[model samples]
Target chain A: MLDAVILTGLTLGAIVLGLLFIMALLSPLEALTWWAGWTSHAPSPGKLSEEVREEIEAQADRRREVGARPRFYLVYLTAIGGVSAEELSYRERVFLETLTEALPEAVIISDVYPFSVTNNPLTGERMLGWLWRKIHEKRKTITGGILATFIFARNLFNVAVSADPRYGPINNAGVAREIAKSLYRHDYPLAGDIPVVIMGWSGGGQIAVGVAPFLCLGLDAPIYVVSIGGVLTDDPGIAFVEHLWHLQGDKDHFHLISDILFPGRWPFIKNSAWNRFKRAGKMTVITPGPMSHTGKGDYFDSNAILPNGQTFVERTVEIIRDAVRTIQPPPPTSIEEELEELLGRGA
Target chain B: MLNNSLRSLMAISPELQHALLVLFLAILSLLFGNSVVLFANRVSRSQFIRSLLAFAFLFLLTFLFWTLSVQALSAMVFGVHKPFVDVFIIVSQSFTPFILGFLILLPHLGHYLYALLRVWVVINLIIHVAHAYDFGSAQALVVSLLGWLLLELATSLSFLKLDAVKRWFLKIATGKAEYRDPNDLVMAYVRAQRALMLQAAQQQEGRDA
Candidate 1:
């Protein structure tokens, strides 16, 4: 009886291992199929929630009232654990709000889902949405943590797809289109000459860098990336980024994976995109004191305080605000100026 | 019976037809290319039918040689003597991953994928060799390494110019291997898409005017 029980357990374990092995082998098919147009049948922007539509409308109204054209646009790409385009975690929402307050000249666009080329979020518009939702619900449990690796692995493959020379171009083009559509919806003119900032957190940073060149070409704008504890690759898109301001806490060692896995990031590979950008004086690496990569003292943690009495989130906002100020467009005509001009005409 | 089967096979869908062609070309390039070169003098190319027969014979000869090499190494290194037919079947089956050899033609990523498949073949060989001979994993690994070393020594001794063989295989697998930088293609594609979008917008403006 004991022998039979042992045999059954071993068989089950083997089957699970085989399935995982097969999954790893087939991970490249996602980008391959998207490039070949075999999948990604979801609509371009998918379904926008009522709240998102209302927010877009409010943004346009505010711009008109202020008599100011947004000097620049800030697009925030969420982390890999993000489940949807319209949804933002509480801390992420707070960070964006802080940015909006600090840099009122910049309009924030955060609806483009970076994990997918078609902007299809994991929990909506995808055929396997329910499966991801199931995994996300139990992600804190032991078995759930194990299952969550599948989601992370799938997104990691996307990062590789963007880094892959043969597939990066096609996938980046698709992602650029998604961002362009989001920008257009937010009253960004196709012919607008404003600079665009792509702010990515965690794995979103790699996707941000991967899509920069194509996004710039598509929108005809100067592109910059603000990476916050991002695991970045030595992608060719770095060449096209006008400036890249990468912020990390000294305790944040997650990015070392890129250094270990990608030979291009090695110091010996001096001609790599990362090294080239560094040499060109267009790259800035900022270490913002002691903090973890994601957990209690991560970049977005509002309660994590520094010696300077500022929260971690506040410091991140301050750094990004300074970066945006460097690239800010000439001040637009303010509402007060327009009103004063009308009063002078009346007098 | 053969004539009837040929008629049915020719009636397959276009997608199936393309798949079959891709499979045949991949097999021809991966399985038969090196073997044909090795047996060039022995293969009679007087007629199409004769050449076809020679191709099958060369494939079998290459298979026999591979089986013998693995069997000899296993016996010498681990004192395991699996049956000749069993070893032959295992080695031949290990080539299954090469069915996707057409992917090796992909521009930049293809080169890496092909290397990965080669690694996969080695791993497949190690697992099957250990199972078939009932040897420990370490013993099987040593035997595999010995076989690989022997092949390398033969190549280094000028049995075949490795570079020339690689160039020939690459040429057969991917004609002209033109390195297309993804950045250049993406820039061009994005420019084209932007132009189209602007054209559509202008058309809408004209209609409104």
Candidate 2:
């Protein structure tokens, strides 16, 4: 009887352990954290709050009075876990603030998308309710562990298929659409034609490239991309951008593995469509030595001596300023000129 | 040892040779581990034929791991896709080069010949993998290197441990038992080889004197 009882207990324990293992494998916490990190730069007090928005508008109006073109700099912050830019940790906020201060001419606007749904000041039950609604609207069933396993497997299969711009879970298209809508929205007024520059850091670089084609089509202006230690798959849509500057540190081992994971980025591989687009001068790759994957250490310090005398940050800033200055606006075309040219060709 | 055994078997009668072949197959099946054959026999409710077939299939599958590793590494790294069974067949057939392992019975020169055959087998493996997976020369070279690393790890973990197990059995049978750790046995073998080489050199010097 004792043996039988022990055997039964062991069997039950094994079943419980198996179930727990499956539950742990299918937990959404990791995916949630990654998404949260990706969209942590969502516009905060400056864009979301009414007082800050009015103050920015007043500043822009004053700048416009000085005959300056209303230049909008939309910077995508590097990965950090926060609902919005307002809630970003002290260090992250300071970094973005410093960047904004450096670009004194342009009106700086920044936001995180697709994950902006998580941008709420509330806590506990309110956040849970918000998450529940978002999941419910997406028609995702997360009640049981078995269903979660199926969802996870499906995501794995999708990643294996391409890891392209159409990766479903991230909803790159939806994010692009949302950004386009925000840019066109009447509330945030801008004078004259808006010259917008889109920039992202780390994983945000992939998001920037994914959204560039959409921004180019919607905004009717040139789009420039700056990717720093970013993981990006070769997508033909990147051709729509005026120029893409990929700045990577030579010591960045993590960034190098991105090429292995996403084979489209491998330069030597032939017969890839992305490689053709890359060879067309649309993409410029710069490997600045003595730089870490995270632009930290000697790379981040302004006084740090480099082989080229200039510090890493100084070189990076110079490259970015040069890229911005080299943006040539599209020449105007009139209907009369077009008709005359066509008539002359026919003659 | 395999060549000597085969030569001795050839001097026997025809009927004895047939029986010996069956016994050899049976022993081979046992050496491969009877668990798979027993499982097959239990599940199928068949005679010895099912077990024999299962043994053959399992033996072939071992070689298939080499091809699968190459294919998987290529697919993951270069996004090259190929049929699994096609690779398996080519890899299994490429095992012909390893038949030179029997040459180990040819005394001192046998070891050199066997080492050469191993390199030939690796070349055959690389060719087969490249053909089956439709990889370019450079990609195939990378796949072969990675496949070799995978095969070496698998071999050390599984097959190489059998030598230590055999040594343990011999030690017990001879009653010359020494408490030797299995992990340290590799170093012991290296030391033995060095001693043998030194003895050979001293003998050569004495002969000259």
Candidate 3:
């Protein structure tokens, strides 16, 4: 009886430890599921909490009353969200707050998804939700653990297989369409002519730029993109953007992987398309020396004194505001003139 | 199959001898995974008669920066009474493990292979440093590690365009020959941001009034 009890205790302890390990590994996935559920329920700014929605509406009304032309609709897309606005990653939260303070009249919509796992309209679950449910529902049995492991392995395989010709741009475009529809439905009464600016940090930057062409077509509005250390691809959607301001830190080695993988940014390539974009005054790339991949470093730190008297965070905030101001529509050119210019240019 | 083809080519052509030599060097450089040996040779030959020379020269220049950086750090830390040429030769030979770098060309296993190769190279470097300087294993390890740290800093600085070559590139690109100040770019970004914020605030205040 004593031996049996000891064996049972040891087995139970091992099982508990194993479960804890799995949970720790899948914590991000679990958080993603919760965020998906939250976002699915509140698809748009209108569906946000009554108090938050009312506050935004009141602000828009005030702006309208003041006859502010070209009302700005700013959408802040989070990267694989589990954290709320209050609990946003330090840099992300700082960026959102800075934007809010800079563009007081702008309607800022946060927590917009760039992709979903299920085709379900009401509960558009993300990849995390499927993984979370697989583990949570059958967690008591050994098969449950096996199933979770299988799912994780399968996801890894899928990621490896789909690395090239990435589906992110397509999925992000879909999210952009949804956002445009939401903005149109919500702000039609308050402001009809809305200039949609989509801002994303890191992977979210890929989504933000991906949404540009879709947002432009869906809303018929001028689109601006602010990418912060974004792992961007050479997507044709960039052509639709009025202005794209890319902020990178010199220390952000991870973000530079895109350039290595895609040689479009290579300086030796004559008539590089991105260079043309820069020359045309459509794209601006800024490398803030002291910033890190996650906006850590002197640029994001409040107490860090830069060579200039200003703090790094203050400098970053200034850059963000400048990027926002560069979102004006391109100067009008006649169709004949455009045709002549195009014909005049040689490949 | 590659070895067989190379053997057949060697039998067929006497005129292709120099070309074959260049090809061998190219392959050697690739196996070494850096430009140190290739660059030293290319610099000795002034004018490039072949395209391979140009390629080797570029790689050599790139590799020289890293090797030179390591040598400087090693000299500083170890206080080794060795000529720069001897230091360079040992340091170049230390990259023997990187011949396995080609394993990183394989998909899915690249990350693992590259990581393993890095460890192997570091171990080789420690051993080489110990042998070359007649230092104890522990002392060699300390010297190698400090030198590596400096090399890492140099590599990162190169990537950040703080290095002389990259700074020159920046000057050429911008058409503004400015001082190589690290904070210059950061300050510009900050200035733009401040101006934008000020403008926004002024506009907001004006509307309120």
Name the lDDT value of residue B16 in candidate 2: 51
Better of 1 and 2 by DockQ: 1
| Candidate 2 lDDT score at position B146 | 80
Ten contiguous residues with the weakest lDDT in model 1 chain B? B36-45
Model 1, span A1-347: residue lDDT tens: 99999999999889877765555445445554554434644212223334333444444455455556688899999887777767777889988999899998889999998877778878776678899889878888999988887777667666666676656666677777788778877777545467889999988898889888877766667888999988898787888899999898989998898888776789989998888888899989999778688768888889989988999999989989987789955334333343344334431
Candidate 1 chain A, run of 10 with poorest lDDT: A42-51
Candidate 1 lDDT over residue span B1-209, tens digit each: 99998898799655445544543554565543222122111222233234444444445554556678889988776677877756766675566677666555342355576788789978887887888788788987876656667666765776567546644543444342122354554465555555545444444445546
The B-chain TM-score of model 1 reads 0.51
Stretches > 4 Å off in candidate 3: A1-70, A80-87, A115-169, A185-193, A267-276, A298-300, A329-347, B1-209
Displacement of the residue A133 alpha carbon in candidate 3, Å: 10
Residue A337 displacement in candidate 1 (angstroms): 31
Off by over 4 Å in 1: A1-17, A40-66, A140-143, A328-347, B2-113, B116-186, B204-209
For residues B26-134, could you state the per-residue lDDT of candidate 2 as single tens digits?
3353323222212211222242344445445544455556667866887899987666655555555555555444333221233355567667867776786678677
True contacts kept of each: 0.21, 0.00, 0.01
**If both were scored by TM-score, which would come out higher, candidate 1 or candidate 3?**
1
Model 3 Cα lDDT, one tens digit per residue, A9-53: 999779866764444333222212322233243222112233323
What's the best-to-worst order under TM-score? 1, 3, 2
lDDT of 3 at A64: 55
